[model samples]
Structures are given as structure tokens and as C-alpha cells.
Target: MAITSANQLELLQTAEAVAREKMIDPALVVEAMEESLARAAKSRYGSEMDIRVSIDRKTGRATFTRVRTVVEDEELENYQAEMTVEQAKQYMANPAVGDQFVEEVPPVDMGRIAAQSAKQVILQKVREAERDRQYEEFKDRAGTIINGVVKREEYGNVIVDVGRGEGILRRNEKIGRESYRPNDRIRCYIKDVRREARGPQIFLSRTAPEFMAELFKMEVPEIYDGIIEIKAVARDPGSRAKIAVISYDNSIDPVGACVGMRGSRVQAVVNELQGEKIDIIPWNEDVPTFLVNALQPAEVSKVVLDEDAERIEVVVPDEQLSLAIGRRGQNVRLASQLTGLDIDIMTEEEESKRRQAEFEERTKLFQAALDVDEFFAQLLVSEGFTNLEEVAYVEIEELTVIDGVDDDTATELQARARDVLEEQAQRALAHARELGADDSLIEFEGLTPQMLEALAEDGVKTLEDFATCADWELAGGWTTDNGQRVKDDGILEKFDVSLEEAQSMVMTARVLLGWVDPEELEQGNEDEIDEDAVEASEDEA
Candidate 1:
């Protein structure tokens, strides 16, 4: 093979054909040909020589060149490709250290081995360009639905032929035991697009919650128009699913619109999902209300939410318990996922028993802490005074409002409660000091003596230790582990320390220890306030 006048136009013709076949830019194919020709030219010439090739896009002519760059005397390692400033004077009137001298060179007459190597190089370059083109084309298409034809199955994974690329649907991403044969048409969600050594990988999914949401979007015009929004979706793949939707337009009912006229719209989605049962619920800003709707077909007698823990307790009638929990707890699990909360469902009788137990426990605490009789402690408990702190610091009028309790009785009650609290505090302080608590921690304004004891027991004896602690470590929190909520116990949680209070106390400790700059903290707060104000104004608009 030679770059003769007869074959010069053939190179561009071949490049155009290859580019058309690969669906890539003709310029890229031409560039690949130039690179391959340069590689063959290097073999014909000295390997150290800097050989270059250029193809004229319009004329289809090949130009080969030898390039030698001027360099400092000590930097001229490549004798054929680099020239010292002084040696470069022979080639030009004046040449600087960074100048390059180019001379036209004869094209190579490639032998059988050289031509074969050049062909491989061109093929590699074309493949790389194709991969890049595919990656660029599909990267933005992620999180969307695509129609493809199933090509084959490797092990348990299904390979689909998308228009310009191949998508892989892993066994785990398939709905249930769905199987496909060659040339079977399939609809899937483009879960991800990645560039790899082999090629661009387009991962497809049929079990993604977003897939169901997208299906509804496709079937519902209101959703596509943004009149109705899919707020949340939870699915058990091909078995059961729940979707919560909200409507911005007051006239449009989100649930009804999603269900469509005579269940036609939802039915379309259901058919695509392989008969997956779906419960469409109206989205609500109130979490409990949304949860009640999520756990549909079950009558909720009462709802108790622990906001800080992100946990909810639902009391249903005994007959509805099984219905709320579903078969194998699937209903509650889907509801929890839909609402993003950990739900604990119980019967009304169970809730009553638990409440009675709590009441008895509070009465016991009051009786022991205040040195009051059972009836008096029960009365205090019934008045909503759960702890000695409330009884000690509450308004005199609040205690006086209790039956048979006058101002004098309230005053006596408060006196005794405060004395007991003081004694308990002193005992806690002594215990904390015994456990090697530092004065700096004990003197911290926000932490009570009991808090110090708890901290000392937890090995946080110094202000530095407190400063190093995260807010959740002192306030307790719920963490999602393996899709289940796990409780993290906090040392100060028993003292009813809220997350916000813990954050403030930790920040205060850090400031006192000079671990954080007060000015920077204040500036951050100001920035947050400004951002919040801007958001508030935007919401108002």
C-alpha cells in the first residue's frame, strides 16, 4: 500500500464510508487515517524521528512531514527530533529554544506487516471514537425511558439493542422473573450510562421506582404538563407499589387524574409493570396525613409522630392491624418508604395499654422524687407534670389549677420539688467528678449537672471532647441501615436534649475552646439567613 496520487482520493473515500457505517464524524475517521499513516511512516523512517501526517479535507491529499523542535543544549535528548538552539541556526537564520522546524517527507510504501499494523491502528481509533460518541449521546438520556430490542441473554443479564448503543439489564434490575428472547421488544428506564474500557455501558432497569413514576408521567398528560407531580413512589417490583401525587391546580384531583378515566391511565402503567398492583395516594405536606393515606384500606385510630427520630406510631383498630401491616409487613414497609418514616403499627388496645403503663411510670417517678403520696403523685401526673423539672419550675397558677390544690399547696409542692431536684443535681455532680469530669465541662452554661454525669459516663470528660462530638451524638437520632431505621442512643438524650439545642451547645463549646472562629460562624449564619429570606420572598411571589 502506498500514498500515491491514485490512492490519495481512495483514502478520503474509505474514511467517508467508515464514518458513515460507524455514524461518527468524517473528520474523526480522517484523523484516524492520518494517525495510522504516520505510524507506518515512523516504521519506514527512524523510530526516533518525529513523523507527522495530515490529510487535506477538500483535496483528499496526504502530506507527510518530519518535525524537529529546538531545545536547550542539555534538554536535547532526542537527536533526530530535538535540536539545540545553536544547532538549529543551520536550518534557520535565527531559532529560539521552543521553535519547531518542519520539513516535508516522502510518504511510506507500507509492506504487508506495516499495512496490517496500520489497519489495526485505524480500527482501534475508530472504535474509540465510536465509544466516545455513544457515551456523549446517552449520558444525558439517563433517568429516562427507552425502547429497545432484546439482543441476547448472557447468564441472567439481558442485553438490549438501543438505537445507537447496547443496554444491559442486570438480573437484579428486572421485574420478578421476567424473561426475554432474542428480538423481543422491551421498555426500560435508563438508570445509568458509564464509559468503560469495553465501551459505554447503558444500564437499564425495569424495577426502579422512578420507572413506575416515569410510566405514569408517560400515561398521564397532566403529569407531563406539570399540573400533577409525583411526590413519592415505593415499589415491590412486579408485586405491589405505592405512588403519592400532588396537584398544583385546585380543580385537578391528583389521584383521580393519575387513576385516569375508568382506571385507564394507571392500567397502562400496571400492564407495563407486569401486573404490579399500585395504590395511588394524594400527597400532603402533613406527614401524618400523608402516612394515613399511604397506609390505605386500614382505619387509623390514632397517630403519634416523633419528629426528631423520624419515627411514627399508628394505632389502628384490632381488626385493621393485619390490614395496615399487610402480608409479611409489605403494606407498612411500602408506606414507610413512601412517607420516608419508620412506622410502628399497633392495635388500639395495645396503645391504651402502653399509655396506661406510661402514666403509671410517671406517677411512680413523681411519688419517689417529690416524696408525695400515690394519690397526690397521680394527680400531678394527670396534670401533665411528667418530670420533677416541670413541677419545680412551672407557674404557680398551673399547679393551683389542679383539684383541691390552692396557692399554698402549689407553693409547698414547688418547694419540695425544687429541693429534690437540687439534691439530685448535687449527687449527679459528685458522681461526675468521681468519674474525672473536668471543671471546664461542668462549668459549661448549657449543660446541667445530670448532663455532665452522662457525658462523663460516655467518656466525654472535657470541653474539648464535647466540642468534638456531633450534634446527633448528644441528641440521639435514627439512621437508615439496609433500608431499616436504626436508633442511635445519645448520652444526653435522657435529658430531652433536642438536636438544635445539642448543635448550639456543641458550637458554643467549640467557640470557647477556640476551635472555631466566632466571626466566621456569625457570617455563615448571616448567609443562611439571607438565603432563607430570598427563598421566602420567592415562595411569596
Candidate 2:
């Protein structure tokens, strides 16, 4: 009364039907049959025996057999044991010294045990094929948003049935405070699908930055058509997010389009994500402005970048400092991600104090050398101007206008300033000559003879010297032919010397001095030769 043979034919028919229905090849069934029958025979008979199993594809009927050799000596073993010549010749044609024989084995009954074995093989094949089919079905869906039912929640993980397979929504992957009941329909992003021993593993996430990107793709027509692009996204799920967006089309505003009318589109996404707030900012190539925009709803006074350290210090008003930092530093965190800067938020007062300290230090240095409050005075000294002659030729009126200098102090400092400017000019000329300028000064078109005299009086007697003068030095006192004064004009621009080229001129002058050979001074006409002394003779002539 064993049930093994009772439904053998019925089971075979069912396997065939399932294979055809699922598009699984029937050859696999035959393979399963062969494997099952071979195992069944091995179990019933000794494993040392050679077992052979074959199935007729058309009939689905399977046969199991064993092959054994014919040996003269009864003690000889093995399926192909040595046999007598007469016996070997009877089975093999032209039997020789190394020839063997093959005999067709009679089919076995495949009793209750074998039938049960075959049934198990069919079930395994069906399950494996189904798993493969499911993997193929879901792999193409990675990154797409899919609607699925939440089957259950266990230990903070929600198991969602995404049609062909189950996708796991881990604890962190769920939006904050978002609850799901069994059979609750929800939309989630397909993060990845991987093959596992049990089945195909599908990872679902509602917290991925791509979730926002995909949601935008669904709601914004511009983004869907590729006119507007979501350049980057930074999010704190169920709380806030910062997104940088750009548009390929000139007419389109990527942020505005994503927001929609009265924030309908973005709000729709927020609703889906359990009301997380979203900040959409315009992308910019400028790091400072981009950082400002990234830290939205919080006003930024300034962004000081520390390029070497890869950090940015953001200064905002004391009131906006907390806002810029956001709740638990979320705003700054998202902004940092968006702008790719390690941002440190500071109050305006803190930045002001830091700036004040730096100014005081520089002021101390300047005041230490000379009784002046002008930071530019320190800059002049750094440029090598230390005497009254150097200050006279180069303009110092502009220094008074900079932060922390007053008009009365500028007037008191004017003579000392002139001497310092002139000395800097002379030092600049010497430095330039050391860099290789042996020629007389190259007269720039606008510079008058009087200006040259004033520069010479300040000890700036050469082109090499003139080029060292800071631009702001020429911004005043030097009168145009129209009697108007040019202010902070870039002196290098007035002449044809690059600071490098000018330095070369100075170097050459220092090397040549008056000993400039004919070859060295071989550059101009007789009239130009007299150009350097022409000022002295102009009035007499």
C-alpha cells in the first residue's frame, strides 16, 4: 500500500506541464530523471557497481541498469574484469589483447523507493528554475521605483513583496516615523537585487538620495525629458534634504520646475517620504556662492576657504548661526555634502573677532616699524620700501582710503609715506636689474617727464625700480595731459613690463651698470639715447 507508484505517471505529467507552462526546457526533466534513477540504483545496489540510467524523451519512461564483465576466474572483480578470450570475442568484434565488451542492461522495476527519489528530483528542478526566473524578472528593475505591499515588519525591517520577489527594507532605509502595516501598499526605490541561497534578494530603500531623484523624475516633466538635471542630492530622510539642480535649456529654471505651482510637485514627494522638508538650490561654479546657496534659509555673511585644509569657515549672523547649523547640525551636514566642503559654522561676532585679531597683529607690526595705523604701510615695507625718497614718487593717498585709516593721519603720514614709496621704487629697480634689465627706462605712453623726475627724486631711477611700485602707488598725484588724476591704476599695465620681465630688466641693469657693452646697449637710436637726460635739458632748450 505504498503511495510511491500510485501517482508516478501523474507526477511525471505534472512536471511536463509545469515545464511547458514556465518555458523551462523538458530536457532538464530527463536530466533530473537520470540523476534520480542513478541515485536510487546506487542506494539499492552496492556503490562499487557501475549504474546506467536513460530516459526516452518522447515517452518520459526511464530505465535503470548496471553493466558487469564476464570473467573466467570467479575471484576477478570490477565491472570490466579480465575475461577469457572466447567470452570477450563473443561480445566484442575483432577482440584483441586490450579490447573490452559492452552489454545492454535490462531495465529495473524502479520500485517505491526509486519513484519517491524521482519525485524529489522533479520538485528541486522546479524550485531552482523558478528562482532563476524570479532573478531575471527583478534584476532589470534596480534604481526604478516600484509599488509593493508591505508583508510584515520584523525587528525594524519591513519585508515588502515586490511582485516576483521579496525586497527587504532595513531599519535605516525607512523614512523616520513612517509606519507600515501588513499588506500596506507603498512605493520604494529598488536599491539592488542579489542572488542568495534561499532566493533572489531584493534590497528596497526609501531613504536613498536616489529616492528623491527618482521622485523628481516622476513629477517634473523637465527632469523626465532630460532638460533639467538633478546634479546632486543630500538628504536626512524624513527631516530635510538639499538638492543641487541645473538645466540644459536656457529657458528652464530647474529648481522652480521641480517645485511646481505652490510647491505641489515637491510637496507630493515630501508626502511620499512622510513629510521630509526639501531645499532646492541652484548649482554654481563659484564655490563661495554655491556654499551660500547650499546653506539655505540661513543667511551666510561670508565663506572663508582654507584650500590647503579643504575646509570652509561659514560666518553667519548670531541669530542665523543656529539656523545654518540646523537641528543637530543637519543643515551644515547636507550643505557640506552638496558643496564638498568640510564646513564649520561660526557666528558673525566670532569671525569679526578673528578678523580683528589679524588686523591688530598686522597693525602692531606696522606701528612697530613706523608710527602709522595704515596696514598698507606694512605692505609697502614688505614690498621693500623703507625710506622717505621711495615714498615721495609712489602715491600713498590711496592707502588712507583703505579700512582703518583716517584722513588727518594720512596727511601727517604723507611725507614719510612718500619717502618710503620712493625707497621701495629704488629697491624694486635694483631687484628688477638683478633680474636682467640693462636698458634705460622704457617710457610708457602716458607717463610724463615730470612723473619720471618725481620717481627719480624718490630714488626710483630705473625701469627695474619703476616696475616694483605697487599699482595703488600711481593712482594719485600723477596728472594726465587733461589735468585729471588716475587712481590705483595698475602701473604694470601702464608700461609693457610683466613683473617677471621687469625683474629680469633689473637683474640685467645690476649686472651691467655703466659697463653695459655696446652689444648690451645696442637697442636704440641716438634720440632715444638722449631720452634719459632729456628732462634736464628740456627747460634750457
Candidate 3:
């Protein structure tokens, strides 16, 4: 039936009825009416039109008023177009060019266009208000499970009514192999709430990480109480899931608590997830160990990390390779996601081959570059001395204890190694001094000022000291105060430096000592020994 004046009154009453039924505030209807009327006037007459709308509390009817400006000029301003100065004088005397005027728009006939337009505006306003209400209702419930009645499926997405609003469970968010029927009461986590032109859009998810986290929360009170912290979670939705958990209190086992007695707690979650399996593993700060746990049912022998590449190579026994890798690599794939690493799974045989290749390469370098004999090389291999560092650093005493290596052999080998090391050290020192180490040399406790002076006189100013003296002479004795020649070892003890250190000192000392003539020393000895022999020869002549 056409809505007559009586029908309009009934419409207002019906609006009140619907508002009450929906638990919607009646005042919101009045506000919506005002807004709708204002919007209609603005749309029809432009916003420059000064219009105000008032709503009746009892009848819910709307009244409109138009405002104008009083002005001196007969030409009406936008706000004074409907009024004359004489009409505006009652409200404001001595009206100026910009003065405002007020009047009520005459009650127009209830034409189809105007009435229909107003009704449309009121309906739109009501919908907007309803949408806002729904948004507020659902926003606070985010991250919690809500039981929803399935409305329909559109484009593979399930539309569900969540009491006050409709939520969309997108196809991508639905668990694979899980089914639902219309009107089915399924529980979903409220992932988000958003306002739109039609209504509030509540987005739901069945595959979110929080879904599993919430399942644990429901089963384990400790999780809700904050005693346990869910460090990270990985899932395949309906198949299997891995959740890493930790407990603040040392006494509680997070995995055990989450599992519950006879698996009842976890079973409850599993049933809700449609018989999906769950592994509640304890979290560890150690990355390798955490990764091993993440790849459960698969035994991991060891995990080798390549930090720069952000990858980890996991070694599994030949028997467990398939288990560790899982069907179609799902196990290792989820583990990679959980541990945040690119995991490469390998069998013991493969890793052993890699280790063997590395060893062979190192051995080749030792044999080719270091001239290490087969016997000594085997000893180095057995002793874990794979690199040049071990050979260069092995002590003489320790080397002497090895079979076929006596004290003399050990000493000679140590001396050769020392020579190589000293040469390298001198070259480094020279480079360092070139790079500004002149002042830093003073910090060397091995080089005393007295020793430096002695070296200065012998023309042994720098590592260049090797240029003037033989290795044996530089490696030889130091002169004592009683004119006795003490060996380098004795001179080394004076400064608490080693023989190699004394050699470095001797290089410097040669410069300080300068060169003494051997011929002059021989003649001086003759002068002291045979002044009498000279006289006897003169007598014989």
C-alpha cells in the first residue's frame, strides 16, 4: 500500500520497532534523520543554501529552516536571497551589506521526487549508522574465536553472520580438505574488522598462525596466564603443525602442559582442526638445536651453518633421510619456515664425501707448498694439524716427543720454522713502520734503548741489518764486559727475550756496534804476545 500521512506515522513507529528489535538506540534514528535531511538539501540546493533540520522526539518527523543575510543592497547575497531588508529588520536593525537573515522554507507539497529522495537519504543514513554500530561491535573481538552461522558461499568464500556483522572466510584462508555446510556452526578467529559502504566487513581466518596459538591458549591456561610464551609457530592448516613454546617458570614443561593428560588437551584442538596432527616442541635459543627440533620425526646427526648464505646443512643418517625430509619435503619445508633458514638436508654419506674432499684439498696444499713428507703429514692428520698454523706453531719439545723425531731433528725443524716466521715478522714490521709504526716501536718491550744504541753503532738500523751481517754471525755471540764472548742465549736472557728475539735484536745491534777490523785484532794480539820474539829475531840477524 502507498504510504499516506497515516502510513508515514506508521513508518516512524515501525522504525522505532526495528531499532528496538535490533537493540539499536532510538536517538540514533533522530540523528540519522537530521543528517539525511541536511544531506538532501545540500544535494538538491547546493551547500551554499543555509539549511537546518530538526527532528521531533515523539513522532520522529523532520522540519527544515532556511537562513539568510540582511544587507543594505537590494541585490540579495546567497544567505539573504529569500529575504528583504524589511523582513530581516525585525531580527537585526540597521542591516548592512553582509548582515544575515532567517526564514522557514514553506511546507512544500508531498511530491513523489522530494518524498522519495528524502526516504532514500534516510535509508542510506540508517545503513551507515548500522554499519558503524557493527564495526564497533566486532572490533573489540579481534584475535578471538567466534562461533559463526554460515550464511552462504559466494565465489568460494563463505559468508558468515557473527551475531552483529557478516564476516568473510576467504577461500585462501580456508583449510584445505576441510568442508562446511550452510548454517553450520563453525568457530573462526576474528582476524580484522573494517567499515565499508555496505556494512562492516569482519575478515576471518582458519589458517592464521594465531589460530594454532589460540588453540593452545584454549587448552593450556598457562599460555593465557602469560607463564608460557609462544615463540613461533608453523602450520600446514589441516595436515600437521609445529609450535615452538617456552615457559617463564623453570618448573613447567611447556610441551607437556600443551599436550595435556593422555593428549586430551591437544586432542581437543586436533578435533577442532579436523584431526590434524600437532607437534609441541620446546624452543631453544640455539639455532641448530631449534632447527633439529623443528624437523621432528627426522633424526638429525648434525647441522652445519653457512651464516653468510643464511643456510643450514642438516646431516641425517641414511635410514632417516626420507623421514627427515618428509613427504614431498613438507617436514623440512615447515622447519625452514619455523627456523627462518634455508635448510638443505643431506645424508651422512654425502656430508662425509664433502668432508673428504675438503681434507684432500688441504692435504694437497700441504704437500705441494710446504714439502711435508708423507710420514709427518700422516702425523699431522692424526693430530688434527690440518693447517699451516699447527706446523708453524708446534713447540720443539712437543715435536721431539713424536716417533722418528729426536731432539736434534725437532730443534732443526723449529729453527727452520722460526727462520720463516722471523722473515715474515720482519717484513710485516717493515710494512708497519712504513704505515706509521715508528712511534709504536717504542712500545716494544723486547727492544731496549741500550740495545737500540748498540745496534745503531753496528749499522744494524732496521730489518736491513741482514744485508751487512751473515746469518750465522747475526745468530752468534754478544760481547761481555770482561771481553769474553757470551753466546746469543746469554744475551737473550738479559732482556728476557727468546733466541729468535735476540736475532732480531742482533740485526739492530749490528748497526749500533758498527764493523770492527779482524786484521787489527790479530796484529794487536801479536803486539801483546811477542815483543820478546821481535828482539830475539833482531839478535839473530
User: On residues 330-372, what C-alpha lDDT tens digit does candidate 3 reach at each position?
Assistant: 8997898788777889999999999888777766755654566
RMSD of 2: 19.0
Model 2 TM-score on a 0 to 1 scale: 0.61
Model 3: how far residue 384 lies from native, Å: 6.9
TM-score of 3: 0.64
Q: After superposition, how far is residue 380 of candidate 2 from its true place, in Å?
A: 5.4
Model 1, residue 369: C-alpha shift (Å): 3.0
Best by TM-score: 1
Q: Cα lDDT of all candidates, in order?
A: 0.94, 0.72, 0.72
Q: Arrange candidates by TM-score, descending.
A: 1, 3, 2
Better of 1 and 3 by lDDT: 1
Q: Lowest-scoring 10 consecutive residues by lDDT in candidate 1?
A: 476-485
Which segments of candidate 2 are over 4 A away from where they belong?
Answer: 1-12, 20-30, 48-52, 63-104, 362-541
Q: What is the alpha-carbon lDDT for the whole of candidate 3?
A: 0.72
